[model samples]
Target chain A: MTNRHDHRLIDGRAVQARILTELRAELERERAIRPVGRLLSVSIGPSPEIEVYVRNQARGAERVGLPFERQLWPADITQEECKRRIAALNDDAEVLGIILQRPVPAHIHVRSLQSAIHPLKDVEGMNPASIGNIVYNDVALAPCTAAAAVELVRETGLNLRGLEVVMIGHSEIVGKPAAFLLMAEGATFTVCHHMTRSVAMHSRRADVVVVAVGKPHLIGPDMIKPGAAVIDIGINQVSAPDGTLRILGDVDTDRVREVAGWITPVPGGVGPVTVAMLMRNALTAHKRQVASGWLPPATLRGP
Target chain B: MTNRHDHRLIDGRAVQARILTELRAELERERAIRPVGRLLSVSIGPSPEIEVYVRNQARGAERVGLPFERQLWPADITQEECKRRIAALNDDAEVLGIILQRPVPAHIHVRSLQSAIHPLKDVEGMNPASIGNIVYNDVALAPCTAAAAVELVRETGLNLRGLEVVMIGHSEIVGKPAAFLLMAEGATFTVCHHMTRSVAMHSRRADVVVVAVGKPHLIGPDMIKPGAAVIDIGINQVSAPDGTLRILGDVDTDRVREVAGWITPVPGGVGPVTVAMLMRNALTAHKRQVASGWLPPATLRGP
Candidate 1:
């Protein structure tokens, strides 16, 4: 007799407050014509989980009106002075987006300061040329937890083409960029890592599973398939049994929400839609640096 | 009664003559200590199938000693003059490796002259930073038909960690870099494509399938699984009902080599180990441009 609150939990802070209210109405119509881009965020040493994820990304970049900053440095900086301050925020010009942050300092190589951040100001897409331009689907700044786990598997409306999904962590920042953004949405995925000999024989024939393997629960309820659409993107912490320390994910959400039909519930799922996909990848890296002329486009100033 | 040529076919010219005799003894010990790299091969027009693939990559770069030039051009060039002659053979410090050659001329932007070559002389890895450095396993130079279909699935010696695989075709040059080099050798892959709803329900539960969908037979022998390890990576051409023209792959291989225990055939499999993996990606792009000091390291001059 299943029914553990009959599944469907995926609210991710109401899908990160409806993508920060459509990125605050497209940054108030591109900041009423001009001067908008800022992101930055660096942080070299300090962790209380990187200052609670840089104060929840400066309160989701001031509730999506964008502009965030932060910087910091000295925890014995050198990694060539933190890649010369991330190559001066990749030659600033009002830095559209950057993001370094992580428990840095063990001789910081962090993928060479995430390959010295400029895949158009890598907005937390953590550049390897923005994860190899998601194999030429030409993904614009992906990886905010693999674009919030492919936006919670497109909020379960399903039909990501021939969707079979299954992912379960292969990481290079969230299971191979969430299986290259679910193979650019023609999903027929299945990555399963830690050399998956049988992650429940590919998550019980997935229709969508996701997981992101940090492992606390390591998916259960016979690795769900009943009404699939799982998504987890784990954030483990564990320790309970009265020693308290909670926060767990990689499924088993009350027995996979009593046999899944849409799950995602670790501290309200995919962590507030991965901080609203890092403020929609800082307005998609400021509309690809204003469509590659590298910024300077939104003009029309004060009427 | 399955004997349609029992199985174990994977020869690919005996793994391209054991990887061109260990890249001709590491290019005769780095060309008996000196002058060793040159691969260019550009091409723009005159295509009798790109002059039979630049005469099989200048006869596999002169039977592996290296130097293979070609360059061509005028089939109505101009994609900014083929990205200014591939950025002048990417600043030719003796061109180490380039290879643009395809059916160019449809207003040229062949991935913008393959991003103007030079992901350290690309060596046909078709750079998006060498396919996003295969998500930081930092694949020296991949995509020679996805590294000859993961070296014919490691010559089916299995044990790519948890080996399940499947792949079929997502193609960023051979199914998403052979599912990111079989998820960096810890397999359990599964890409499938053409909106895979049921590529025989994930190739009858793979143990290793691979196909690379250029779709000829599209994998058969009841979608292999009996003894798996298939690897096809399609070549396709077909016409022969005595109307000549043959070559065919995407697996049917005389009925999936009677339920594949290891298959790989269709013109001596993965087409001559994808030209000996483009001469082992031109000696792995001249040992990554001599380990990124950008050449000048192999010196040992005259005995």
Candidate 2:
């Protein structure tokens, strides 16, 4: 493939690969001593929307040499039953972490199920406890997509301490968590949402701008500073003029890259790194479990 | 006492009084049907600093007709024992909520004890679960001081929707939680901590500025925009020229008040409202418990 994009384009796949390589080596050292656990993906119904995520996560896990399993419950499963199954996974010694697929049955209370996953094994970081820990600057285990956004921002080599960051969303999953993560990095951040009167005003003054508002091309070149880094976490699909489907990010990447010091492109930006973050979180969960004595110490096997 | 301050001074006592009065009436109605539970304050060691807080909380509980209990555990109590006692309180029907006092013994893990308190009985909202819930826009149960700061901002009659809010400080207890509360109220907030390069730059542009950093007189008149609302959550004790003790807030209130449309005074500002917020949270906890079937419905009593 011919390389046409400029150097300002943040290659998320390259970042994701670097993380997986490090994680793979770490897991190899861990596996030499004891057995590693599998990452269990629980889908409490038919969730076609999350199938892509499942495949990406499985691929990432495989690259890190971690076992991956997928479970599909009946679409009509009761919320109580769903929680009961999650509790079982939480207690399972063979399970390293749990990933609860979204778009669960309408009857199932997703938050309740998320809460059921033990924090030590909450690789997806969807649990309220995991989210809450971020407030205390405990960002080791955080939501994957949010962590991924922060990771990409770090990749830009911007000095996080005292950096001006503007997060263009306040969602529970991405924007809010990302704000706390930035805070943990000692960056001063402003959160803007639909309620914000002027997003550009904040973005233009920021050293870095992260958008997760699920709006395509919402940020233009004029909205960014000349040397500011822009992280686009939005994944929106729209039909092009040729009657073909296309994925677009919140930032107008074509024009933004011309002005932005660095920018993350759609499809190849936050998405791949998000899967990589899941892998990193799984390793962190495993290491924490061992440190906390929640899991048995590794028994030396045959050399 | 003669009132010397101008109308710009926000009387937290007044706001607190109004809240307590309404709670008193509501508790009276509940009392006619059934008994309200007591708020148990657990102190691990002898720390005289929180004594005033204990008294204020007791008084607030009394005003609302809720029973209050102050339990002083041994200074050498183990962390496990503290959690055990908290678990018992969580199970007790008479205990409407638990308040784990701060400055716990060095041997004790305070965060662990806070987590031990059941969410339904965490009237102080110090539990991770309660704090995490605020991220999801669930603000009914939040940290008292943070909620008090937000409450006073609301008292200013500023439209929170699209309000330009700048929160100085990022402590987990106050600044961080206050940021989440402001978000829940539809306000655009920026959080500045010790790492922020220019606190005045953000504050000068804010419609409302809330300061929780402990430094006395950290915010000056020049940092604030004219006619803006300033909420001072800092409580610092400093010596006056005569060597007498005087309480000071983060903002230089004397001069800031001239520019600030509304400003809260230290010693009488967030302090009283925090106690009032605790009482309100107690009632909220009780109602949620009842709705969750954790407590029995009140039976009507004969006149």
- Quick one: best TM-score, which candidate? 2
Error of 2 at A227 (Å): 0.5
DockQ of 2: 0.81
Docking class of 1: acceptable
B1-303: candidate 2 lDDT, tens digit per residue: 214467888888888899999999998987776677898988888999989889999999988888899999999888877878887888898999999888987888888888889989989888888888888878878999999999999998989999999999999999999999998889999999899999989999999999998999899999999999999999999998899998889989888887889999887889999999999999999899889987768775676
lDDT of 1 at B234: 80
Clashing pairs for model 1 are B171-B175
Can you list the residue pairs that collide in candidate 2?
none
Candidate 2 residue-wise lDDT, A133-186, digit = tens: 888777878999999999999999888999999999899999999999989999
Candidate 1 local distance difference test against the native: 0.81
Q: Is the docking of candidate 2 incorrect, acceptable, medium or high quality?
A: high
Model 2: residues with Cα > 4 Å off, grouped in runs? A1-5, A300-303, B1-5, B300-303
lDDT of 1 by residue, A1-303 (tens): 223354477878888988999888988888777777678787877667678768877898898777787878788878987778778778877888788888687888898788888887788888787788788888778889888989888987877998888888787888887788888889888888786877887889888888887878878888788888888878878887889898788777877777788888887779888989988888877877888877677675566
Alpha-carbon TM-score of each model against the true structure: 0.39, 0.97
